[model samples]
Target: MGTQAPSDYSSSAPSKMDEQPEKQAKIDEKLQRQKEIDDWLPITSSRNAKWWYSAFHNVTAMVGAGVLSLPFAMSNLGWGPGIVILILSWVITLFTLWQMVEMHEIVPGKRFDRYHELGQHAFGEKLGLWIVVPQQLICEVGVDIVYMVTGGKSLQKVHKIVRKDEKDSIKLSYFIMIFASAHFVLAHLPNFNSISGVSLAAAVMSLSYSTIAWTASVHKGVQADVDYGYLAHSTSGTVFNFFSALGDVAFAYAGHNVVLEIQATIPSTPGNPSKKPMWRGVVMAYIVVALCYFPVALIGYYTFGNKVEDNILISLEKPEWLIIMANMFVVVHVIGSYQLYAMPVFDMIETVLVKKLNFRPTTTLRFISRNLYVAFTMFVGITFPFFGGLLGFFGGFAFSPTTYFLPCIMWLAIKKPRKFSLSWIVNWICITLGLMLMILSPIGGLRSIIIQAKNYKFYN
Candidate 1:
């Protein structure tokens, strides 16, 4: 009868309106907690940095001990290939760095502060983590280890200069320990922004030492009957040395590994996005990079020819005071470089501890974790301070992907330029070249390591 009085079912409609707010509250709570965690983390803890901070930070990041080795890298490659590759690397890396900065805030209202975060956005979440974390860790951790060796060797150079008549009894291992002690104190700094002063000083030191290196070479003039021939005689040796040289060049163009991390420090607004200022800062840094890299590589190579030591400073024995100053600058620059590279690894370690392992974010936790990390890298650096081999090895193996091709791949995936378009063609070209670098350079580096290791003793 009349559909059972039309069944008053409004209250029983099965709608979730009543439960929606409650569920939303839980979601909000979770998000808030995560934000709190991010705020406590090293990377996202501060966002007050200016554009100039980016400039010096990038300079500090890019121009480190690697610049001192550029001439040696050139010696390995010879004139034609060395100049071409050095210039090519500079252009390619700059383009990729631009891609990274553009992609940092590619998604509206979000920022991929870390390399892996952007990787996650481009690739699927799990796959992104798998792709980026291991590679990023390898690049970052590898740099720390290399810089440990760089800092130690630089300190040794300084000591040799200052104590000219000394017996040279102290081992490089001891110098590495002395260098690691600086990081033990420095690693306690809170975040990227906290270390800006150190980074600025390091950047200045980089430019200064680079200037001294090349100018000193100019002053010294070309070696008597200078030979521009390949350092190795055999074809196989030459090929491997060539490959290792690629790694050294690749290593010279660092800072790509930490570009996004540096960008994360600057405050971003919707109207004036972070990319603009980031790009400006990048341009400044690259100019500084060109100034520091080209002369050091070319002039140093020209002055020494094929006889250049793996570290150019090691080759220069004259003008003792200037060499000592350059060596001291290396020490200071690498001090900042080591910390810059280590910050990401520290972030990773602290993240896992606090979030994954449920450790409290206490000073004691930080003290222990950071100190242990410095100690671990110190141990490795001491064990094998094969600077040239390490430069080539880590440079090509890890750096090639992050610096050379990964950004291009990410750009292609995200931007999706039309087939055969300029963007498409360029990205592919970079990918191909980067692939070659990754495959070839590490082989040379490994061979060099083996040769060095044959007569090497542990921690000597």
Candidate 2:
């Protein structure tokens, strides 16, 4: 038997040697197929928006109700510090965005399609989940709550102007409910890409209202008899006020949570499968953001100084129609924006439940869970209608991590730059700044909230 086996082995040995390269070729082909699958972008024809549309989506994500608070933020920081911080935040955020895009190319097969994906890649999966998901929920849901509070207040203002007799009779909660009802329908839309048109409209609305708010501020400033210089009643030196103001600025510039999602919508071409269009879109969007944000902060603060209300539109004295239109624009814009921010939350929840837990996403479970989440946010918004307080709290506690800390951490972790090198040092500085803001902003926000809550009526 041993002699027979040796005879067969001797006969096939040369053929086996000849087959080695072919086997290796098959393995390589399989690997190439796998790589193709891994690097594949999920974009479909309808979802593949152009760069400009992506830019609009980015603008829509960023320039929501936060713009209305810039003047008050400027008041808290004074013109000097506020302008400096605004520009700095813009630059830093843009740089971090570039880092994020660069990091997308690091992992060979996987894409950081969501914000949490980047965190998961940088750190352990569990820590990334804990780090990114809660902040995203808080930032997005908290922002929606702020929208309800602010939008309701704006609607109340509009009603007061349009129907003065019934102004005191209607409750703010009613307006919130109306807005939420409209959003209930809108939020059910399938995905953010489905609403690119709405996002574009929201971007335009943001510009319209920002311009209105700025023009109104200038109009009021010119009409005033007394000269209120930029630094009047300055609180820049006040420890709590300055940090709180920085939180507002952070909130104004905070769109990182949704950037990856928006970037995924930009169609990748065969020649450029990487995120080059995404970079262009980000640049264009940031330019628009800077243009929209800088003037609003500068002019609103210059006009009203420390007298600037938390909602700048509240500070404006305009014709009834103009005020109503401006405020209504905000209401409409936030109505759309609420869904914009909430989409990430919805996607995250659905993904975890369906993918991890093996729950059915297309079933009633999805509908019920999403609607209930919306209801929960609505309940919270109606319960605490303190707009500025919510803005500051979320900005500090949520936006800081999502907007600043996580980006730096992701870059450092993925790139693994030389220890204590310039990149390392810069990341640490960012991390430190983020930590400081995280600690201080909530305190200031809570103090303001408690102070305001003392006199706040739920439906007033």
Winning candidate number (TM-score):
1
Which tens-of-lDDT digit does each residue in 12-45 have in candidate 2? 7767777899899999997975454323222211
RMSD for all candidates, in order, please: 4.1, 6.1
Local distance difference test, each candidate: 0.92, 0.77
Query: TM-score of predicted model 1?
Result: 0.95
Top lDDT: which candidate number? 1
TM-score of each: 0.95, 0.86
- Which regions of candidate 1 deviate over 4 angstroms? 1-25, 166-168
